[model samples]
Target: MGKSHVLVIPFPAQGHVIPMMELSQRLIEQGVKVTFVNTEVIHNKIVTSNWINKDGVDDDLRHMVSIPDGLDPCEDRNDIVKLAKSISQNMPGKFEELIESVDKEDDTKITCIIADFNMAWAIRVAKKKGIKPAAFWSASVITLASVLSVEKLIDDGIINEKGMVLKDEMIRLSDSMLPMKPTNMFWVCFEDPALSEVAFQIVLAAKQASELTEWVLCNSTTELEAATFSMYPQLSPIGPLLASNRLADQTGHFWKEDTTCLAWLDQQPACSVIYIAFGSFTLFNQNQFEELAFGLELSNKPFLWVVRPGMTKETATIFPDGYMERIGSRGKIVSWAPQQKVLAHPSVACFVSHCGWNSTLEGVTNGLPFLCWPYFSDQFQDETYICDIWKTGLGLNKDERGIITREEIKSKIEVLFNNGMFRANALDIKEKVASSIAKGGCSHSNFNKFFEWIHEKDS
Candidate 1:
């Protein structure tokens, strides 16, 4: 048999794209020819960032393929609803063209199209071509399982076009298998039907996923989602795909990651600094910003925070009067840091994260406990596993006005830092993750099974 040619596409966010790249690399190591596809805009950034060198891969065997994303590079990233709608409408034709053009030049036919579960357009195109289509959901299995429960949510009035029911609300889901908070399920609170419509498209895509292939792959591990698997047995759990020794040589993100923070970490005491990043996509308003500032100051712990410009208010520059001076020599806040490197540092003790799947896996792989402040999407679900199931993280509460108080923030950080049981639990998950990524571990076996399923599909 010739090389099994695979085209891997992921949602063009930093979190989603990174794992797919890792998976692509792993497939290539298994003698599969890989083509990693990103939107043209993101691809341009990848090139300009000088992250992936021309000599990064063999002259053959692997390449980057970028097609039109139907939006200009300067378009608004905040208009996620619009962006998602446009991509859903337009991506199929471009995908078909890309696959056809590649297949025309090489006899190794496109054996599989592994795509982000959000990118539903690929499935129809793959079906048309008589090729295997595998959907890779970067979120947790429980989140996907919850998403599959959307109709039930609508029926129970747990979710509506305006917003979901609040955590303390009377509405209940059909099963406690995917217990959820209001903001956790989907982002439809803007009172605009457009957001809900966009959300519907995402759900449609996920619901259709169960129909598209038997090989629905999630970037999660069985160790993490034993409960989710017990609830929904059909889904595949092959993830927490962190360093795994293979990604050590791979390129970083499309933007240059600041390494000075690592130098700062090197100077701190062992397990001393709190690593805080809400991820690249999340932003806060002014009130929330001020609270976090005072909270971190009051915690009296060494911390490193990545605060992007415009991440808070129009007056984002004015964090607080003399706040930085108060935390002098203890806190280092920058725009963006090399996250995986920072988390891996021994000086980094805990992670205050949004619980994005990629960051969660990175946190676990580095043996860092968490202060889980989830923002949107499946982050709350991931946080549920981290805090509730895995006993490795803690959650923050918002007031009636949606503000997380400085007092609450300070308390949670202190608890997570001082609690011995939290540390022990985090280390246990860390060791489990280590073994899973080790040779002939559970993830490795699942990966082999993934391939065997694909080959069996081919045969």
Candidate 2:
């Protein structure tokens, strides 16, 4: 190949796509050509507003292509189980055709195929086409480690092959792993038996995908998950793959950000604003939603909250009567806030987040402590680390009803602000994270190592 070139395919979701896009930009910076592929639905939504005018995606360095995800227009793309089933079954042939067409059209043969860990079938497709394939896990390596250990969990009788816990027991995968309850796991409550089984199948696919790859690129730093990295020697941590200042304005958003939030932050006193946003998938019950609103009101602190539509169970986001006028300018709520921007603002004291891996990393990167009210899955795991291992944040305990009341929210915000200890710890992690992604840092060196592999002849 004249120049190292790779085709990057991400499982179509906001969290997954953004990091892959960032990785593409990084590769472009290192003189590699990238054909960034997306599902036709996502491609059509993002093509105009995001990539075309984005600074890092230049004509000569990178290109965009899309294939059908096999989801009908009427289907819910956010339905995790359905999305997994449809894409896994329908897209293999379409992806194979796209790869063939790209090879035929480009003078330079594609050197590598980097696919999301969820898309295990891509490895087979790549092997058939005479290209190298690598797995990319977009979440925290720590979380992926838990996932990769599911089989071991089954072997030890902690969980079955289907990821069902054998009984109501506390289980530990490794000494470094957090103690997990049998019932609550991953990012959300899998209380629904049907949903849990389907969710487990997706994890099985991701694990199989991991075993097939000799190379793996993760959107995390070794500093973030040292023990996890030691356990899995193949994973290469080269992330916190944020869009730098040059690409910041251009990086695409699945939802339009309310730019007004920036000005709102300006009016708040330093370190007085609490920033809240649950990433793409966390849904709140009507009770949870009203409680969150009441909690924000009780805090008496300036805040910015991102409430995306469909975030609530019923899609009803109505506030209590006189809710806006009561707080006036003290609180600002938007359908979507420019999260990276809001977190980095000087006035933002802490984050009331769902503890999604991306949100966790962003909070750490910004030196802000967390109010961890994890809704489900690996988030509960992440909360253990933030509160126990890292000592960088406080988690809100659920009430007798298993709900985090307004008082709990208010209390956590007070704890983060009234105390200097956790804030100091968060800043320390921030320094380490920033240094890792900086020039001559660990992630940068790892990126070089990864690039060297990309340039090598395929076996």
Candidate 3:
């Protein structure tokens, strides 16, 4: 048999792209040929940001390619529903064309397709071309279970065919699974009813396509969600798929990471810095932004904050009056940060996070307790795991005005810091995560099996 060649595609968002890239890296290490696909926009951002060539060494086994997402240049990519619609309408044909072109150029024809669960349509495309299809889920196993259980949810009268929650209540998929709010269901979390319905349709399509997949790989471990993994025995966990596990820098970042913060972190005392970062999609109004700034100041502890370019809706991220001067050298603010390294820094005490899955895994692996301030979708579910299930984090509460005030932030910091159990629990979870990725561990064994499957010849 010739070399095992695979085409890997992610859902085009940063959170999805990063883990898929990490998985691609593992494939490259095993001497497999990989074609990593991204949308044109995402491809440009990653290449221009210098992430692909950061080390100045290119891997011959891996190739990065881009396909149109079916949106015009001026279209708003941030609108999830619109992006989903465009991708569903346009990508399959473009993807098939790319595969044909690739086959004409490369001797090792594409043998398999590994697609993000959200982009399961590609699995059908693979099947049409006589290629093996595998689904990759970058979020929690329970979240995947929830999406896959759409029919069960509908049969139970919890949600309708369109994913609308008929009854507003908490639900448990099984006796062993944790309870989840209907409003927190991934499809229904959007505030706009129309958008929610569209998202529901996209999810339904994904579920149907996912049924054609031969393997379902998840970026989680049984140690973290034992019951959920046990409930769906087919969903294989081969993660916390971090670059740190291989001692490499992470790739697939849309923004260039500022490494200067590492120098500043070096100067701080051990476990003294409050690290705050919300992932790419989070946005805040000016009032809330100022409250967060003031709250960090109120803590009076050293801090490192990732204030992304569009973090706030305002034209500029305006801080409180004289805020920079008042805080002085105690805080470091960067547009984007190297989060994995930042969390691994000994000077960092805990995470004030938006609870995105990538951030959750990064914080947990680094043994940092969390102050969860989730914005939307799956984030609330992750917070439940952190605060309620694992007891390794605390959730920040909002006031009657729907604002998380400076006082609330300050108080949570105080409460989190005053308690030692949170840190201890975090450390314990960290150890389990490390063990899972080590030799003879669950994730390690699963990954080995996946590797073998990827190389297996057709009967």
User: How do the predictions measure up, each by TM-score?
Assistant: 0.90, 0.94, 0.97
RMSD of each: 2.9, 2.4, 1.6
Give the per-residue lDDT of model 2 (tens digit) for 1-459.
Answer: 469889999888877888888888889888899999889888776755454644424479788778898888888886767887788889999998888897898887888999988777887788788888888888777678767778777788877777777766777666765676756666225767767887778778778767767788888887888778877878888988887456364354677778899998998889989899998788888888888899999998888889898888885777878999998898898998778888889999999888888788888998999888787777887888899888999987778997889988888888888999999999999999899998898788888888889888742
- lDDT per residue (tens digit) for residues 1-459 in model 1: 567889988887878788887788778777788888888877767777666655434337778878877877778856878678678777778889999999998878888989888787787788899988888888777777766766767676666633345244533243455466665565543455677667766776667765877677778877777666666667777787655464353343666666789888989999889899988777788888899999999888899999877786466456798887788879998887778888878899899998888889888887788999877777877887888788998999999998999999999998988898888998899888777756787777878998876566446
Residue 98 lDDT, candidate 2, scale 0-100: 87
lDDT of 2: 0.82
Sorted by TM-score (best first), the order is 3, 2, 1
Which residue runs does candidate 2 get wrong by more than 4 Å?
48-58, 182-184, 187-189, 247-252
Clash count, candidate 2: 8
Using lDDT as the measure, what is the rank order of every candidate, best first? 3, 2, 1
TM-score of 3: 0.97
* Better candidate by lDDT, 1 or 3: 3
